[model samples]
Target: MLEQGRLGTRQLTTLTFMMVVGDMMLIYPSVITSYAKQDSWICAFIGVPLGMALMAMILKLCSMHPEKNLVQMARSILGFWPGTFFSCFYLFFFIIGASTHTREVGDFMTTQIFQYTPIRIIILMFVIVIGWGVWHGLETMGRSSELLMPVVIVFIVVLAVCLLPQVDTSNLKPVSDTGVVSISQGILVSIIYPIGEVVPIMMILPYAAKQAHQTRDMLIAAGLGSLILATLVTISLLVLGAFLTQHNIYASFVLSQKISIGSFFERIEAIMASSWMISTYFKAMIYLYAFIVGCAELFKLKQYRMLVLPASILVFGLANLVSPSITFIVITVVPYWVDWDTTLGIILPGCLLLIQWLKSYRKSSVTPNNSQQ
Candidate 1:
């Protein structure tokens, strides 16, 4: 079992918010606007409830098996071989997810700030820091998030305020110009990439110090995170407009570049980048921690910290191999990646819940028969 009393509800909430927002904060505006046009904010709104439902499902599973994390629960409920298979699958999912986050951090730094720096160097530097956080365990990661999240929030608010003068409310007009089909597509993408990514919280939920109302806390965190994403999307639409948002890969970064206050507070994209880097680091750390813990559980190892280095090495290699280019990443995200996540996030967990329920029902029926006999 995970070390108890290591995390409180507040830390878990902050971690969830950071994980859900993750790299999506930088790129989602552009991706959603490409599909939903000026109504990308609407996609965020639509995705909120769906995101909550997904979170609730994962929380229910965690609540059912409070003493065990997802990997352990799978093993106990699904028997040895089958459980090991699913656990390994989840491990792979987290590794791939973490690698993508790693690549995203490198891509942003290389393209936006350090034009001459090699991407591999950026990836190495980031992985080392992330690996350090994971090696110390979840408490360190949680505390780091608690300290950094406020700064991130402040930077985001400042960026929004600075860009207010540039906002064109008319840019958000003709809201449904893309029609229902396109807007629906955007909503699905929004939920899948950012909101639905909260599935990994299942692994962390068992570690919370206060577990009495964890489900409620998780939903609130996820809802608040979605709301924040919606606010950023709205800001992006108003300031950058739909056309520019769709064309720019890092729309929020581009939005930050537009921030200026009497020319003295100009070029504040560095601040924006820093906030994004913080969010991405926490995001990657959560995924990396999950991957490490899951592997330890799968192999029945007592210490997960030992796996951190090898895992980081594997993730670094995969980050470069899996994402050859941003276009390829985008192409895969919509069709293949989202669907795969849905299977692990919803379908597999749902199946496990059903099996667990059946087992309980059978046990109850059997007990009644034995008493009668």
Candidate 2:
């Protein structure tokens, strides 16, 4: 192994939970609403099992390989040069993923809360903190997640519960009005995101203390995360309605403002925002960590910590250059990013798995023939 850090069962579970919720809280409602209209919540409910299926596939693939990560496993299955090419492509995915995630944090900060701050300044601040987290290593990040995840869950639950009274049942009237194709599209969008993005976690899973139960831990976390997003999307549709949720870029945040229990329990959007940022931090930091560690593995470097500074600088630069404004991310990057995640997370691993199975089967048959002869 190129890195030396371990994750407890709790740390792994919490980290997975946070990764699923991450930035989805910011943009998913509008994106899914645009796809399924009023049927968006239905897509959320359907995604739980389907999303876990995808997660289970990834986990099964990882467990079969034991200590090997995506990079090493690919190299072993494919020839060195071919695998290197594939791994290089994955590295590109990780860095770009990190950059775009960083860009989102900057974009969100400027547009919503820190209106006066320059985008680069906001990105730079996050890059510093995120880079600092990656600087420590996976165990450090895992421990931090264990501590912070509870607060995030509480905020998300509170946001949903507090906004229930405002939910208009009629907003969801004419449900299934979008028809099957549109609902499928919406469900696909919901799954490919957050769940698809969980691919990067494979790089760190080798560091987990117990491999036997990672699948269960991941499934539970993913299911919980899926349901939580479902609740948020459902409530967003019911409270803000399909029209408002589709139009509102920050539907979750705006939904937070809708809380009104005697006025004293209102204006707690900050609490919700904090949870989103924390999850985003974990997501982006994990990507960057994978990039750094992947680079170390690629170059045969002794440790990944040395690359942290340069990688952080690269992320900061790319984040600014990736898009001119938040609209580009919402309009252009958001949709395509899902495809990117699916390709890297699902398709690539599935291919590698099939190849491995064939090779094992062939080897088994050859051994029987040789023994009989």
Candidate 3:
């Protein structure tokens, strides 16, 4: 009971990994292929340091106010009205993110594996499981992360091993064919979608165990997770080739399909699919946690658990209504994600850090003189 809402460092690490590797592993192969062609892995490699820097900026901000969530700290620094407005905006972003993720999971499952069944069913089922995780609190979510992450990693390693024979070293030739401009463009897009979008994790930092090394743990988790993602994306490109990887809707899934062992061992897509499902489930749970917490903070509700059901309902409804089809999600939803996530995740948070720096400068300048007086 005492540990109900609290999360240990290892759990937090796993949660961070789960948050990143799921949807990112699913979409990034294709996104990078779209721009960099055979050079797509370059995008991931280029983005990693930039992504780590953005997260470091956020972590520094969190260090400045260790016990406070972004909502509370912003309100304290910006005053009540502006803070409340910012909080509302962030909460809205988190909820819309939940809806978007719900839709994505539904679409992915229905399109790839559950075609005969309605997508609505998939969405509802996902929402229900996610709601349960939300209600149980962040500790349970973190534990789930701990339990599921190893499986995800193992599957990734297995897939990589399987695809080794198929990898065409020629595919990686002339890696700079697109020049710096194209690779840079791919890096920019990849940064915003998967990495910049991690700003929401600031809310969970306060819930992590109160250790002096909390920040260190988080950074390590982020680094290791990014490496895993970068490696997977690189392998996908190498084995599948950029053109085939791009055309394949789920490039990672297709990569698994290519898995072969001698003349007999094959059809490991099911194992890959199961890993994806677990990874995606953890991801949806984190979004659901953010959504529930945001709702509680916004409404000044006493218990976040109470909002879980209504939030799930909201997520389920919007997931279905957000796009006419998966194609629409690709065309419309993704660009909007790239835009809004960049603004909130990168630009706004960076501004907050600047403001805090200025505030510290002004205080230091005046405090010594006032003491002399």
Candidate 4:
């Protein structure tokens, strides 16, 4: 069984919320709106049901083995060889996710703040800091996310509210002009990135305070987070319009630039930058911690700290190698995310659920009396 004092259901829920809105509030609006157009908000809006379904599947798997993390539960349900192999696959995914998030932090900082700084230096700094946070363990990660979440939310809300004067409704005009199929396709594209990314959360579910309400809290967190994401997406659309925002790489940052209150309240991009930085750092730490723990579990290590430094090196190196340019990063990550994540978040969970049902049926057929257990 996983150790006690992992994380409470509420904390896990909070983590989920922060995960969705944190770093994502920076890039998602621009990319999603790029495809979905004036109706891009509609894309995220449609994601509500899909996101809930994904969360439901994940939570059900967690519920099956209340005390086991995804790696452990995979072992129990699939037997030794298959489970071990799949666990390694998950570990790779976690490591890659850590690297990708590190890239995000570096790209944002270098582009917006330190234009001349090398990406390697920025990535290394975060990797070391995140390595330290992960070494502190999950409780510290949870508390830090909880403390940062409110400040992040307030910053976002202020930006959204301030954009009220600049909004242009006509920018969102001609809804569904691209036809139902196009809009639907765009929605599917948009949903794949954010909602499907939740697959990584399965690793953390066993840490939830109460197994009984794991699904409940997962849904709650997914809901609250999606609501926040969709709201911000909508606000971005209303504030900047679809055309201009589609061209701007950091739509949220540009929107932040537009927030000026009668000449006194200007240059608020710094606040948004600060908020996004906190979220980005937290995201990097969370994924790295999961990767470290997963490695420890896989190798049967006594403690996870041993791998933290080496893993940080690997993650920083990979982040540096990811993209030559931000545009290249965008071109690559968009489609790759949709395809791979569909397999991970949607297909993988569905397969697990179906296999569990089949096992239950077979056991019932073999020994109806003892099968009750």
Estimated TM-score for each candidate: 0.94, 0.98, 0.96, 0.94
Q: List the residue pairs that clash in candidate 3.
A: none
- Per-residue lDDT of 1-373 in model 3, one digit per residue for the tens? 1124888888887887777676777777887678778887888787777777777888999888887777877887788789889888788887777788788888888888888999999898989988888888888888878887889999888888888888878878776898888887788876676667677687888777787676777777776667777787789878877788787768888888888788688888888778878877877777777767765765667777778888889888888888889998777776567678788988888888898899999999999999999
- Quote the positional error of residue 15 for candidate 1 in Å: 0.9
lDDT of 2 at 320: 92
The ten-residue window of minimal lDDT in model 2 covers 209-218
Which of the numbered candidates is closest to the native, going by highest lDDT?
2
Best by TM-score: 2
Candidate 2 vs. true structure, TM-score? 0.98
lDDT of 1 at 165: 87
Error of 1 at 223 (Å): 1.0
lDDT of 4 at 354: 86
Q: Model 2 over residues 1-373: C-alpha lDDT tens digits?
A: 6778899888999989988998898788998899999999999899989999999988888877878877888788887888889899889999998998899888888888899999989999999999999988898999999999989888888887887778789999898999889999899987888688888888888888875666787899999998888888999988989999999988999998778899677888888788889999999999999899989988889888899999999999999999998887778877787678778877998898888889989999999999999
lDDT of each prediction vs. the true structure? 0.84, 0.88, 0.79, 0.79
Better of 2 and 3 by TM-score: 2
* lDDT per residue (tens digit) for residues 210-326 in model 1: 656766876888887787788889999998788988888898888888877877888888888888999999998888888988888888787787898999999899889887777
Worst 10 residues of 4 by lDDT: 1-10
Global CA lDDT computed for model 4: 0.79
- How much does each candidate deviate from the true structure in C-alpha RMSD? 1.9, 1.1, 1.8, 2.2
